[model samples]
Target: MQRLVLLMLFLFCFGSLHAQQTEPKKYLVYLSDKNNTPYTIQQPAQFLSEKAIARRQRQQISVTTRDLPVNPAYVQTIKGTGVEVWYTSRWFNAVVVRGTAEQLAQVNALSFVKNSRSLNRISSPSATNGTLAVKNSSGTSSEALNTMLAPGDYGLAYHQANMLGATELHDAGFHGEGMTIAVLDAGFPGVNTIPAFAHLYQNNQVIGTFDFVTRTENVYGANAHGTSVLSTMAAYLPGKMIGTAYKANYLLLRTEDAPTEHNIEEVNWLIAAEYADSAGADVINSSLGYTVFDAPSVSYSYEQMDGNTTIVARAADFAAATGILVVTSAGNDGNKTWKYISSPADADSVLTVGAVDSLGVVASFSSRGPTADGRIKPDVVALGANAYVLNSAGNLVKSNGTSFSGPIMAGFATTLWQANLSKTNYEIIQLIHRLGSKASAPDNTLGYGIPNYSRIVTGLPTLGAEEGVALVNPVTGNDLIILLADNWRIQLTELQIIDATGKLILKKMLQPDQERQTIDLQALALQKGVYLCRFISGNQIATIRFVKL
Candidate 1:
């Protein structure tokens, strides 16, 4: 009986030891305070770059506790407890760590530790079977490389820029110069060596890079999604292809782990955003979105996409509120069961972009949404389907996803902001929304539609005289009245009304004194979409937008 009892005790001890060895889990340890931190709000220069501080000063934003770094002593104490610190978020006052249950318990016992929660169970890469792996290529096609390197006109790319009136913006000398953009994505494997990015390298436009996934500066060794995404904004192989913001500087940050998806990536994104804010990024383009995760237990539901629930969504809002223009993709899940946008894309203040085709039609695969809170999401649309992008193999490829669309819009937005340096980020966002194709009539499929940069630029306060044209009941059933401001009447030479696709639907040569005329579109059988009315009076031109219901 004594021998049997001894054998049972040995088996129980062995079982406990085995469980302890194999069951280590990842956790997010929330800290109660930033007390005794060396940084302070008054010493903003220490935490924020000169440009970042300049932006804050221009916008009248104040430095607060959120800007302070996490206490090093707390991190050190957690590390001393044998818990490996994965990442720390100053925004949330928390640190992510990996350790056994016993170690986590010890961390929880510390006075500074507020609370801790299990993020998810860590599994081997093989165990995941690419469940949540980022869909991007790591290898380049040789044929594509040769074809892409050959000089050609801005072939397929012109359509994208033209659709949003970005070509005109570029012509006006607003090509995102003197702007800084931060791209957070899964990775950027060949960005350093790509021929298309040579200008960015030569001009020192690639200002910074970091891998939050691995906690290293080696961000150019992972997946190619970021490389393709960055190409939409920074690639500058003139004649062949040019990005929307090729002249803008960039900071590349890898927040998504292509091999896995978990809540931790959201935390990583928040941390990276804070880093970008400190680094003085004028625009942040994040092609990464989160909805589902490898661990089913921790996956977010559609209800959580209310623009405030998810950690990443909150972070995106914070980034926007802090004077940075945040742009995120509206996820590629239109055909899936969860046919709606994911977090960060659902963020209210951030510009959530949806995917459209070269013909300016919403892509079937583009995510749609009135966010869980019933706010019209995807603030604008951009050409993402068959979007031209430079791959890791130095080849221009046609990529399809809102991932490309967000960066394209972001680059253009930076250019717009560059032109209007006096405008605050919020004002810029509002202007972009107000200038969209369907601003008067927004829906979940493509909220606000594509932006009209040409119209926006023409309407800027710095621009000469404001166009006195206004549409009374812009969304009219059949009759549309073009009201002219009661200013000195100028002889109307030619009036042209064009559709969203720039197709001239009606052209009329007006009499010299014909002012405030009403056009009856019932005769022409107009469809329900946005249209532009161009008025030519001598050398002066004024364009007004109206909607046909």
Candidate 2:
């Protein structure tokens, strides 16, 4: 009776229950083990590319049996059962096959098979016919202060990159050259024809393309979402708009069948990640994440987002283990009732990105987290609110979603990594964590807060830099200014000045809206000596010393 109820309800990715009468065309069949696999860890050269092996070698990651290819003999047997095997995953030891319920049943009964679950595929005209192009007028909505080196560089995309301190990296000649980023998303409609991407074709910056959903080399013409997302990183239109990683190589892989929501997409992500690994990609940017499905029974609960429960999350972690940095979008569910990060974002090894406005304020729609295991997620945030992206028609426009934010960070990270080649992927993540404005106190809302670019290159501890407080340095006798991070979430409750002998020289109460405080050495007739300034809040205190001239 329970089996019939589940069948009637069409349970999806949650388990191995087969559909009763519904034609779940695709299925993921997990194998018992890689036993009898022809490949061995001794010769990873046969499976992993030279560059992939070099990456592992640089990171001191060893080649194990887990890196071996799936047993081809087992796959041959599954094919012998008349089921069309489309893809195989070595990480999950699984195969995605398409067949009738009866034919799949025979393959599932094989001794080597551990379990099988039906994957749903439902197509809608709006998503497939390119009618899902989101459009917004060219308007400015930003509160970020960026240091632009030239007006010709970055154009409108300046605020997004500069907000995260990426402009400094760009100015330092790290335009992501020699780095490769694999973008796994839905269809990219205008990538091949868009004017903004002409430079990519001229320079051969695009390494390859693949459609995991349709199983083809062609990755264009299904949805515009990927096109827009790619524009945030790959488009190279100087004096108009330039992507953060415009000089880096890219692999476009379509894994999401946008019209439907199901667990098969996660399997597709796993497959694409493997392909990227074999293709020698250094970074993987996944803007898609799983949360709910058409069938509520198969939908993921908040508990399943514990980083290990979801197959996609595990795949992300495995991809990261291969010496590749996996960056994903923390789902845009903050404003919704479900309100939490989706799968893959919960993955512990991935750099889960969240969305914030150009002004460094967390977006209302950006997902929140402290994972089910109590780990702070959304390692960082970027400009996603009214973010500028080129549409499928090759026109620069505006859009909203953590989808855009993830790619922005992905591109900046590429440039940053390119500038510093010796740093491991995890080391890069840790450095970003320490440079954030809120490094002293990371919260669920904004993990480590917005990163300061000046601090990244200088490697200096500027006053109030780690405390989420922005203070203008080189204070003179004229005035002093301070810009609080966020809307004063890291409030400045009070400020105290202590003289050379630890004598309390001055005390002042500060309101959350104080915005700035002026202390003049000339006005107070203070001596020219070193003095300690303490910025205190209810939660913590940050102190800095400055010598008065």
Candidate 3:
């Protein structure tokens, strides 16, 4: 009797659960034609639930910043469901829960909407244009191949190889030697056994790898996205493909779980980024985005792509401002309904990348962007078509996506930075933009176009010429005007006057009122023949030749 009663109650509950689930939950719509009637549900009641509607109107939205304070109302507006409706620096404005499918049909039937998707693995293949410095896959002793073969004079494969940034890095001598790059991705399978990557294993270039997903050091598993990304920077191409920074070090982070749906992956990414920063790394390249979540209620609308909307976005911005060069994939949803861009890519100050074919045209699937604040995105482009890549088993595979392009460009950037360690981050970015574009408008599809390394090497004008301080008069007590216009800036912190034989005549702090300052020289007792005036600045020192009579 007891067993029967339990069975009967279970059936009733199961039936009730089914009935409730089949009942119409709200349907989200994406308008195919954003130009006309951007909103599918115009009528207020049909567009939102009473509770949601009230929350939308009453909430305020604002970005997170310690230095920049936000308005209280804006913060209040963002506290509720309508908080997703705020705009980001990427120019994408998100909308909150508007209506159900039945209500949407009554409001306007001509819109596009679907349940958001869970995370998935995406990647681009390695470069395969011509012959790379082939390595012995046998894993025995070092073998040499005489006269490496460049790509044939004419072929699609050859052209594509030429389009890769590895070609640029090789010419610039930034083949990743003595530098470390950490790639935060999903998983890396069979990296330790691959013969093409055997060099890294033997040379200690594979410094360390961690799996943030499981909180373990084992990153080799079910995903190939990380394998492709890493090979682009470290794979040794004996005769087939060449990576950009073949000699550089690497760290792999597996943050995505392909078989699960949870927001914990984002938390994993943040922890990994902090780890990378603390590890004394010079660069961090991530090829992931967030615009969707597991639970229906937690899903993000278009308005939430704002720079400050998510936790990962804040971490990305912080990484860039801290002097670590960060590169991210723009995303792969060009023709899809959610064709805007993904989070972290939408973060301000990050080097967002787009995909381009061998012919220098934008890839059809490369995510397009004009951030919520109307800033142009995809700061650069790289080869991301059906590019050649190395698989976990040491075989060459062809893959396609913006994920591949990012690391290739990053390798080149890393190499260049290694060569010119003195350059500021902004200066390097501006130089690439000025040299890569066709001297016209930079668009969302291709931020500043692809960088041309040859031109950049020859065309980059030095920031300023070196100018030393000099005494204008050889006679006693002559006035001296220190001209610093030719130099970057010259507010000398300390000045020392010395005589010809290197004895200090007088030592004093010389304060410059401006870039060009005049100081009277009569006070110090000075002798003739080759006196030196030393000006000290932060991290920079200048000396001028002077004579006293």
Candidate 4:
């Protein structure tokens, strides 16, 4: 989805020159070092949670000075210059502050302050503001529902779940039983009040809330973008909707300002990611990205998307190093001029996701990329087109964007990790790449393509390829191209498309041709409606139903 890269935000008018110039400027004060910190790496518990420490131990990650909280003495000295210190980042060894020009001058002159980056948005309106919000999930125990619910209870959710092969994981009893996902977005406007999140509240699955944009504990206002994103993975209304990781605990963090595109948002995301790391999150779903910025604030160049350059990208890599698997959208500029994956998505450590329809056709707007440095971006694809998510009113709605797709894959990844708890974050990420569709023919359009969860546990592609109907149906293009499983093409095969009346619409006989075949639907002049596709290989047959939209 366009979680952080929508056009409306490009036209967003945060303030005029007079307002910006008159206001006290906010700055990201980079500290020279983390020397003489009160907390030691040996006793990380002073800053990091027990779970966080355990995760590091499990992954054989050695605690270092980077794991220590920012030096309190350094922060106090910066504040001595009269700038109000807003927040401190341990990883970056930096602090966010607001102050007058004179205050900034004094702080910059301090020997400990390496440099100060302006956090103020420029006057131009045609700059990046924030990622558009969408949904996936987080919640509590699935023990009750697992025992009481059936496959049909998932309703529309079943289709997308199957698309990600999450149903298989769910059925195997790994409903994110012991995982935590941190959702860093713009705001969670309706979460505290929305019915979709009521279950999470009742179960106390929502462990915490923080709005870095406001530096406040309240993340339940400002924008509803986060509400939709949370629902994709957290909502659990049986017979209506269900999240992929509905049983996983959640951390709602508002890191984007939503009204302006500024470098500070990247800093905000960095701090939130750090919070996720310290909070012991097993996964981080940041449906946020960055590219252009307003004037007076320099925008990122295409070359800067090399993953190691941007502040947020660096943080994403470090988060993964700390054992938190990060999942982020590949941006939604594919149809536009700035058509490349955004920062953090470019980071090598995170799983960058792109959007695709049920037909597995790349959504025209899902960003594309071989990263600026030529690394394959959007490490995978997921069903982002018309992804089923919950709105504030508890309505099961279709939301689109890499925004929704990122969470779909994020929650799925979390559940998969729950099933393979012994795997490190790096191993888990590598597993997805390995099981993804045809790693040998990986492309930037869909990265390695949709992940193959069946192979994750079974060590083989699901020969029951009928299950792919959800991912290959509701044809929208003029032609149909089917990618057959190896077994499907092992013998003479007969393929038939039948209308609802059981009348044969089209039939074809193949002499074990290669896996992919094209059927020109335009030539058939087929009407839009439900249809059944039947394929017969040897004595085995399978009939799969699909939709039009």
TM-score for model 3?
0.60
Per-residue alpha-carbon lDDT of candidate 4 for residues 157-203, written as tens digits (9 for 90 to 100): 77777787777667655567558899999888778887666767777
Q: Which tens-of-lDDT digit does each residue in 278-374 have in candidate 3?
A: 4545678888887777554276666777777776787787666545677888888877998877878888867788888877888889888877767
| lDDT to native, each model | 0.78, 0.78, 0.58, 0.78
- Tens digits of per-residue lDDT, candidate 2, 1-549, equal 999988856656334354444343788899999998889999998888777898888678998777888899999999998877788888888898877788888998999999998777532111221111111211121222122346466778889977866666666555776678899998999889998887676666777778787766778789889999999998776677888887777888899989888887888899899988877789999999898987732988998899999989999999999999998999899999978999899998988889999788999999999899999988888888999999999887889999999999999888767644656788778867776778888888788777655555223234566656655655655454555655444455666665544345666766666566555545557776666665656524455666566
How close is every model to the real structure, measured as TM-score?
0.76, 0.76, 0.60, 0.77
lDDT tens per residue, model 1, 14-59: 9987885557677789999999998899998877787788878867
Better of 2 and 3 by lDDT: 2
Give candidate 2 misplaced runs (Cα > 4 Å): 1-24, 121-149, 457-549
Model 1 RMSD, rounded to 1 decimal:
10.7
- In model 4, what is the error at residue 429, expressed in angstroms? 0.9
Q: What is the lDDT of residue 271 in candidate 2?
A: 89
Off by over 4 Å in 4: 1-22, 122-143, 147-149, 457-549
